[model samples]
Structure formats: C-alpha cells, structure tokens
Target: MLTYLVSPDDSALDHYPLLGNALAFWRSTIQQRQPFCPACRASFAEEAQPAAFLFATAAIAPTSASVSAFCMACWNDLPPAMIEREATRVLQQVIPGGRFLDPCEARR
Candidate 1:
C-alpha cells in the first residue's frame, strides 16, 4: 500500500492528474479552517502530519472532483478499493458535479 502525505505546501495537482481544481477547493477549505477528511471527518492540524492512502477510481471526469484523504490509521487498516469507494461517495455529497478518477489513467 502506498501512503501520501497531504500538506498545504505540496500541490495536489502536481501529484495527480484531473485534480488541480479539487486541490484548489481543498486549499480554500483549509484557509477557512475547515480542512477535514471527507471520509473520516478528521480535522487536519497544520503542524501535524497526516497520511492518506492513494488510489484511483473508475469514473472519468475532466477534473479530480474527489480524493480520499484518510488518516494514517485508517489508511493502514482499510483496503485501497474500499477507501476509493468511500472517498467517491463522500465527494458526491460535498462537491457539486464531482467525478472520480482512475489512478491507472494518471499521467506518468
């Protein structure tokens, strides 16, 4: 399993395709002091390091409307497929016109 460290300094777009706008949205959320994992509802602390399990979805969209940001414990306990499904579901609830992206399709 691969783990991704989500930080404000790292550009989500740079790591994943079709996620530039979504990262922007997350940035805005963080700025508002509302940065929380859509799946776990765990708040993010600026000084704390949070880890996420990265996976791809099958849905095709112009932009990465949703991403699974799991806490380290959750990321370690859950399967990648399950995490992807859950993240996709949560994104649908929080974002309008959100779609899932396949990690297999990401640019190399």
Candidate 2:
C-alpha cells in the first residue's frame, strides 16, 4: 500500500478523477472490469498471480485523503515517505476528498 502527503495548495485534487471518498473510490474500482493497482498499474487478478493486490488510503491532509491500490511487490518496496506512520498523523487522516485515476483511463 502507498500513502501520499499531498498539499491542498498543490491542487492535488485537480489531477485525478475525484470519487468523493475512500469508500466511493473503492466501489468504483470493483465496478471496473479489470482494475489495476494505481501505484504500479499492475492488473489486479487472483492472489496467486503477481498482479494481485489491495487498496489503501493515502493521507492528503488532516481531514482529507485519497485511495490507492498497490500490487504485492510494489507494496513491499514502498519508500519511507509513502509508508503511513504516526509522525505524519496530521497528514494521514482518512476523511474525504479522495481522488482516483483509473488505470484504463490513464492510458489515454
């Protein structure tokens, strides 16, 4: 899993297709015919496959965050900055304003 510490001033919300919140974003992913990990763009399939993975909420602010998917390898190789921790508690709240850039749509 990966978490992002985005600045509201950075206009991070403007870059992605906002899905309201974490729950909505995840639901949208499930509706997708072939969902991919947002991090590595790996196609999500059965657990035995390398493309298998799960989702996590990225912390954007004290009251805002976004949802992201991560494949097994990508999740294990995440850098320190992307890992959720108490030090960034203020920026790690899973409140609202979650954005999701569909991997399929991203190809365009």
Candidate 3:
C-alpha cells in the first residue's frame, strides 16, 4: 500500500506524482468551503472552526481514478491498522484494478 502525508509542510505531488489533479480538486473543495468527510459525509463548515487537517487519497489506475477526503477528527480517531485497512478498502472501491505504486512508508 502507498502512503502519503498531506500537510501544509509538504507538496502533494512530491509524495504522489499522480496526485496533481487530485490535489487541485482538494484545493478547490477547500476554497469553496465544501470540504466533507468521505467516511461520514459530515460538512466541515459545521465544525465551528476550520479543519485541523485534510486527509485525502486518490486511487489511480491506468484507466480509472477517484479521490476522497476525511476530516481530522475521524482520521485521528482511527488506529494505524484501521487506517491502512480502510485506505486499502477505499482504494479498491475507487480503482478496482489499481495497485498503489508509490512508496509504502508514510512521508512525514
């Protein structure tokens, strides 16, 4: 499985070269004030404050791709094992034939 750390300190493309469009989509989502959690579909605007973090993922294959986002709370509440398992599950649903091609270690 591929892991990426999306934060203010790092460039998304540097970690996942295939995430250029996905990053752009996430930026636009944030700019539009419509960021929502993919797992719960909770609106970020209702949080009473800006999101502490934006956890996003893109499942890409030669012919298919999809992107999703998660709020900081939901992301942090998950255990490391759960995160990997859920990420893999989400990726499979998004891109059925795609296998992660990026480095496996989390890029901090």
Which candidate's TM-score is highest? 3
Candidate that beats the other on TM-score, 2 or 3, i.e. the better one: 3
lDDT of 2 by residue, 1-108 (tens): 234433223344456434235434544565474655555556654341222212244334234334444556655677645533222332234434333445599679
Question: Any idea what lDDT model 3 has?
Answer: 0.51
List residue ranges in candidate 2 displaced over 4 A. Answer: 1-32, 46-68, 83-108
| Top-lDDT candidate index | 1
Instruction: Report the C-alpha lDDT of model 1 over 1-108, residue by residue, as the tens digit.
Output: 122335434666476754555555655676476565555677664532346533333444433344445665556677877776766566565555665655677554
For every model shown, what is its TM-score relative to the native structure? 0.44, 0.30, 0.49
Worst 10 residues of 2 by lDDT: 46-55
Q: Which portions of model 3 miss their true places by more than 4 Å? A: 1-5, 12-18, 30-35, 44-65, 97-108
The lDDT values for all models are 0.54, 0.42, 0.51
lDDT-best of 1 and 3: 1
For model 3, which pairs clash? none
Q: Flag clash pairs in model 1.
A: 18-64, 56-103
Rank ordering of all candidates by lDDT, starting from the highest: 1, 3, 2
Please give the distance, in angstroms, between residue 33's alpha carbon in candidate 2 and its true position after superposition. 2.2
